[model samples]
Target: MQPLDKSVYGPFQLYYDHALEMWCKDPANAGKQMSLHSVPQMVSYAFQKAFTPAKILPGFKSTGIYPMDRNIFPDHKFMPTYSADRPAPIPNRDEPASDSDSERRHTATTSPAPSKLDTFTSLKEIRPFPKAPARTEGPKKRKAVMSAILTSTPEKLSSQTVTISAAGPSKPKKLHYDADDDEGSQQCSGKTFGWNK
Candidate 1:
């Protein structure tokens, strides 16, 4: 393998590359490299070798390879064997029990008795809530406002003061009343005397 660049993550990069090679060589052993039991030791080794924190590794971040799980090796006991014909051990029924069992039994027995509510057939029905009293302020206040609006007088139009003068009296023609009145009165008397004679 080419020598890793001596950068901040150089050692971690080398270890990661070695781990990857090991993983590629045997995928089954990959679990062992990352198992819970071996991760701390593996991380310690990596730290001593000057590897950067595992979380910052390109492969670890991209592949989500946790340091702990990566180092953990699976226990062989947990694997299932199809050919092994081993029967599971049966539970023992004759084991001595404690007072809690007796209490549990008593509670179970008493709990099954029918309650008074079990025999009840009918329940009092709930009545709908009465509508809230109509708002008193609404109609009364509306009528008062309407009446006040109807009775009020419209505002008067504004007036302005203008200066005006009285017109001069018309001149009258002088009547010749003295001559006309004397002549008319004499003619009326003459006519009245002739009619009477």
Candidate 2:
């Protein structure tokens, strides 16, 4: 192994190196090196500057939880951030999770997370996720979102279906199939192709 060059990190490295070189050359302490505390502090002081805070975060003065001097990120940087309790599923709020589901979830949550040691060599080494079944008609078309101001009166449960509409509500529009209106617009006066009025 080769020794690191003191001036490798540009002018800042050279600047730090110059100070150390001066200290080492000082006749008062010719043999002694800087202490652990002093060395780390010196290194940090050389690199760490005033513009360290990450976020502006309106109304909040401090950028982070702790002060700049207080070492929030210690020597051992990253701690495992996996949650002990997994978050609830965001989908299907209308239907509550059953007891069986809760039990399954509990078992799933209790399973130990794949450790850092779990390494794979090839595609065949790892378990594969189930592939989705193929559909013949390609992808389905997206439906429009329903209007907010719609008021539905279920005449018959089968007849009354929520149609996705962008307009403010379903108005009582008279079916005009064959005749033309006063404004010369072809208003087709005929029955709508549905089960109800």
Candidate 3:
């Protein structure tokens, strides 16, 4: 029998009705009409079978709810991404234009004549940045820096420097081997061979 409590029966009425329909329409029961007396029993049996605990256990495990493991979902689930690189759709060029739209197109195509500001030549006058002060100070400082770097010499380098170590100046090492040295000569002649003494 359907539960008398709306809280219990209200949510289940749709499922119960569906199961009753299936049961009543079964091929085995075809041509045999089910009386009102048999509907509640059939609906109750079908609903119980549909929601059995055995059938629902796997669902809970797949969703990682029973043991609460978050890694059950596969890595590829986070890999799909939206791409903005696709080619834009082709626009329809054969549209039937209305009077207003054609007027707008004509107006947009034939632009107004250039003003005095637009026709003015940029080369005639320098338009320095409004935020910058008179560039006189900057050029003077830059000129001084350039002159100092270009004219710098060893004397200038030594003026600001202090000698840490006065180890007498070192000479570059000379090459040990010359073209006159024989290729077959022993590098250490004092070490004699076993029988060559």
Candidate 4:
């Protein structure tokens, strides 16, 4: 949907301005001569000119979803006024949430406006869509070569097994197996994202 004009949207104009400030600062936009410090109406102007729904929604040549995940207002940036059912913050790979995580929630009732600019940044509460389902799969992978070993054995039959694991970063694409005479030479290779990627 087309965003409403800055004058019509009330205080939320501050929120869009914060987004524009970020968009114009991206290095990819260098030399574009855009600035967050532009005229008051510029954010809505840019929103009309730039945030086409087609660019985010799926369609031909579409960039797919442009997620505006609710940001917790720790500083002077604009943020969505999320509901009490707000989704949990995704923990960073190496950073588990601390005990104070719950203490830091900046509810509209408790939100602070430390500067005059903060007044322009306040946004009305918005209902967000339900969060997507969580992924259930883990990262470990296993390959079995027992059948090949059984068939390629030389002379009298002998028990042989080959196990290859690619749990983390895989390099060199091809892994060679030096099978003994009974097992015969075997090669197995592939790339795995491990569970982390």
How good is model 1 by TM-score?
0.17
Per-residue alpha-carbon lDDT of candidate 2 for residues 1-197, written as tens digits (9 for 90 to 100): 11112122343465567657766788986778677755765556445431123222211223233233345346544444566456646875778889999999999899968888675567555757678989679687889864453344543332344332434476797665654344454435543332221
lDDT of 3 at 128: 50
lDDT of 3 by residue, 52-166 (tens): 5555565566567767778977887665456645665788889888999899989988986666585555753677555766656443444333234534686466544535234
- Say which prediction, candidate 2 or candidate 4, comes out ahead on lDDT: 2
- Alpha-carbon deviation at 127 in model 2, angstroms: 10
Residue 112: error of model 4 in Å? Answer: 61
Where does candidate 2 stray beyond 4 Å? 1-9, 44-197
Model 4 Cα lDDT, one tens digit per residue, 66-133: 34323322434334455545675876676675657646764533887665553443344354557889
Number of backbone-clashing residue pairs for each candidate, in the order shown: 12, 7, 0, 0
The alpha-carbon lDDT assigned to residue 25 of candidate 2 equals 82
Ranking by lDDT: 3, 2, 1, 4
Give me the runs in candidate 3 sitting further than 4 Å from their true place. Answer: 1-39, 78-197
lDDT on C-alpha atoms for all candidate structures: 0.50, 0.51, 0.59, 0.49
Per-residue lDDT tens digits for candidate 1, residues 1-197, read 11223233666767756655655478567546455765565556666666445434544433334342433335564555778756767887797777998899989998897766755544444555567887665543433332324333442211111111233454775534232343343233224212221
Best by TM-score: 3
TM-score of each: 0.17, 0.19, 0.24, 0.15
lDDT for 106 in candidate 2 is 97
Error at 87, model 3, angstroms: 11
